[model samples]
Target chain A: MPSILGFGACLPPRVVTHEELAERLGVEPGWILEACGIRERRWAQEETVVDLAEGAAREALSAGGLRPGDLGAIILGTGTPQRQFPGVSAELQRRLGCPGIPAFDVHLASSGGMVALCLARELCRAYGPVLAVGAERMSDIVQRDFVKETAILFGDGAGAAVVSPAEGPLEILEALWAADGDFASDLCLDSGGPLKMNGRTVIMQANRKLVATVETLLARAGRRTGEVDLFVFHQANLNLLRQVARTLGVEASKVPITLHRYGNTSAASVLIAAAEAWKEGRFHFGSLGLLAAFGAGFSWGGMLVEAR
Target chain B: MNTLDDIRALVAALAQAPLPEDPEASLFEAGVIDSFGVMDLVAQLEARFALKVPDEDMLPRKFESLSKIAAYVASRKA
Candidate 1:
């Protein structure tokens, strides 16, 4: 099984607090905090998605003690690509100077990063080392005037993880993913348009789907939920994550939440949480961690890992 | 567990807002409960009654107001 060798994350310098957004939107400052549990989020003033991705990738590689040439493949997960042609992964590969190995992008919306990790785990079976990065500049597409909910719920950031077959602290145990297209319209952003979301529907569906998918994954893996040392859920909503944790009977403290600091960075969320937690020494040897996410496609997935 | 007053109190507590005394008022339209609030209501109902509300049962109609939630809870209990 492939294991996570190292992880890294990068947030834009500009920090947009809820109070600032609330003042601009003419809403009570506490409303944003109560509604989304987001106190502050980062916005990219001039940095591109590629720049954030490159920075995170470099940090992960450095942490893993590997250079660009050592990577066997690059997998980029992002919903907000700078261009449709020539996916973000290709440019990232070029910038990282890893020209030969396979590189591409996967768009599972918020679940993109976790799905890329699942794919990278499989790729590691054949290739020795894989770099999976999820980067998004959500501020580029958000409409502050029209879509207030989504406007406040998104930020710009990127996260990367170096996965390889080598014995490491985080071993990929199992991965499970599923989607219900019937709810696709619940959250969507058409090209040349601002992101639109049925907040209630998305919340309900995400809660139901994430809970069910995680249960199934745990059952398939034959691991109890109590065995999980850390639960890194997508940083979509803080209250939603807490509700899901309560439903799953997992303690609130065990789940690492980054939504307050970074908002919902979409594909970068779970990986960002994982990287931040790892950096803080949250995972010890033999500790088990679970990562789960729900996104626009009504896509949801979970990955179980054991720290070596 | 079976009284409307009890149900109303639960709804008010979970919603963190007061509901109109009228049983037929639209909670959604009145801004008594939003989408995320609906989730909390469901979780509270499930925990309070030890009943699992199916995803399909989370319709707006089922939770329209205090009376509706009480009726729905009764139906699920039955």
Candidate 2:
């Protein structure tokens, strides 16, 4: 796998606090915190998914010290693409003025983000530089008048990573994932329909699988949980995060949390949180980290990376 | 013998919250554990009892109380 050229994240201009969501839904705002550990999330009032992706992709390109023309391919992992066909990757390619690059989309909800990162690493062996983006308009999948569980649990955002052969800050050590489609009914979003989830099933399955994957990856790499400098987990629920930390005996300081502020942006959550850590210098040089994400297909993934 | 005592300990650990003194008391009714916690308890039960708690048997009713969990475990072990 090639080095990670850059990391970037973009959030919408509009902020929807739990108070605002509660006021609109006529429910207590406190429940949002108690249930999911989110106080606020973003909603793209006028920005389309491509617009968010464009911003993040631009930032990632600039951070990597490359032009859009340097990109050989664009892979977008999105759970909420505005259109069914011709995903945001194609639109992002046009917006970036990279006309002939091979652009495609990977749809796996949250895990798609990590899957894109791993794929970009492999693709970099062939393509010069691959841009991997995880963008989602979870707010769009959630209808306000629908189930409050789904409504208050989503936000809008995008995150991008530039994977290139040129040595950069982060190096990939290992990446692995697994899925069980039998539980597909537990979390489903029908065409032109609001997102529905058996929240408990998602929480439990995600918790178990994510933890196991992290352990398996760590064991495979001959690393211990204590050696991990950072834990970049898919920002789903705060309670779930805490439980994972407890079960794994990982300290709170080892985790970078964005769910509390951004809610669950699905595919965008991990990248957003990782980008935040990078900005704060937490995901710094010599930092060994564990990356994990889970989503709808009952897919769970884990990746190990170290910054140099 | 009932697996009630073992199941009770598992529930307490999973919830990380207080459990009622009554073995027959409902964890859900007492808000002691949510559905996720119930699954966690199931996972622990499977590991401790050396049994595979099938996905179809993951209903909350099967693990609502210590008594229910014990009976389910015994039947599976049998």
Candidate 3:
């Protein structure tokens, strides 16, 4: 199994508090909090998505005790790519000074992070080590006036994880992916337009699919939900996380959440939360962890992992 | 069979916060239930009542209050 050797996250320095956003949008601060449990979010005012991804990738490489040249490939999971012609992974490879390695990007919306991880595990079978990153600069695309709901719910950040066939605390066990095109239009962004979402429909479909995805993943892994130690879900909304945890009978404390501070970083949400939790010494040997995410495309999945 | 009290209790439990006692009060306006909460409420209602709520029926008015949700469920049952 490919093990996650190191994790890293980079959040932009500029913090946008709910009050500031509320003032700008002409709404009460309390409404923002009640609507989505977000207090503040970081904005990449000067940095592009590549800059954030490079920062996080460097930290992950440093933590893993490996240099850029040691990576076999780089996989970037992002919806907000820096350019349309060349994938962010190629630019990241050049920026990291590893110009010849195989690199690519996955655009599975917010679930892009876990999807990249799953791809990294496969690449590790033939390669030495792979760098998987989820980076997004949602602040660049949201129109506060037109898309008020998603405007306040998104932030900008990046997270990276080093996956290699080595001994480590976190080992990849199983990964499952699923999608439904029926609700694809519920959450979407059109060309040259701000993000738009039918909040009610997205929430309803995501909750239903996420719970079922996790349950199926656990059952296939021959593990019960109660036996899992940690549940890291997409930091889409605090209320959604709470609702899913409650429905699944998982204790609130067992779920790591970063939405309140970072809001929804889209593709970077889960990895950022996981990296933060790992830095806090949350994972120990023999700990069982589950990663789940849902996003536009109606894409969703779960991955079961265990600490070695 | 689950009664209206059962539905009310489930709503309170799902809300995870004390709701206004007045059944006609707007849960959305009162901050008792948000968009995500509505999804959970719908899931619970489907399981408890064994009825599929049409997408058209997933409106704010239908789930505006405890009494409204209970009444909707009862209508589905009937």
CA-lDDT, candidates in order? 0.86, 0.84, 0.85
Best candidate according to TM-score: 2
The candidate with the higher TM-score, 1 or 2, is: 2
Order the candidates by TM-score, highest first — what do you get? 2, 1, 3
Model 2, B1-78: lDDT tens per residue?
346777777787876468899989988888889966776677688899999976556656777788888889989999
- Give the chain B TM-score for each candidate: 0.86, 0.89, 0.88
For every candidate, C-alpha RMSD to the true structure in Å:
2.8, 2.9, 4.3
lDDT of 2 by residue, A22-78 (tens): 888788888767767788899998899999998888988887788999998999999
In model 3, which regions exceed 4 Å deviation?
A: A143-147, B1-34, B50-78
Clashes of 3: 0
The runs of at least 3 residues in candidate 2 whose Cα sits more than 4 Å from the true structure, single-residue gaps closed, are: B8-30, B39-68, B75-78
Candidate 1, residue B64: Cα displacement in angstroms equals 4.0
lDDT-wise, the better of 1 and 3 is 1
Over A38-100, each residue of candidate 3 has an lDDT whose tens digit, in order, gives 999999988989999999999888878889999999999999997885888888998999877
C-alpha RMSD in Å of predicted model 1 compared with the true structure: 2.8
Least well predicted 10-residue stretch by lDDT in candidate 3 chain A: A142-151
Q: What DockQ does each prediction reach against the true complex?
A: 0.45, 0.38, 0.32
Question: Given candidate 2, what's the lDDT at residue B73?
Answer: 92
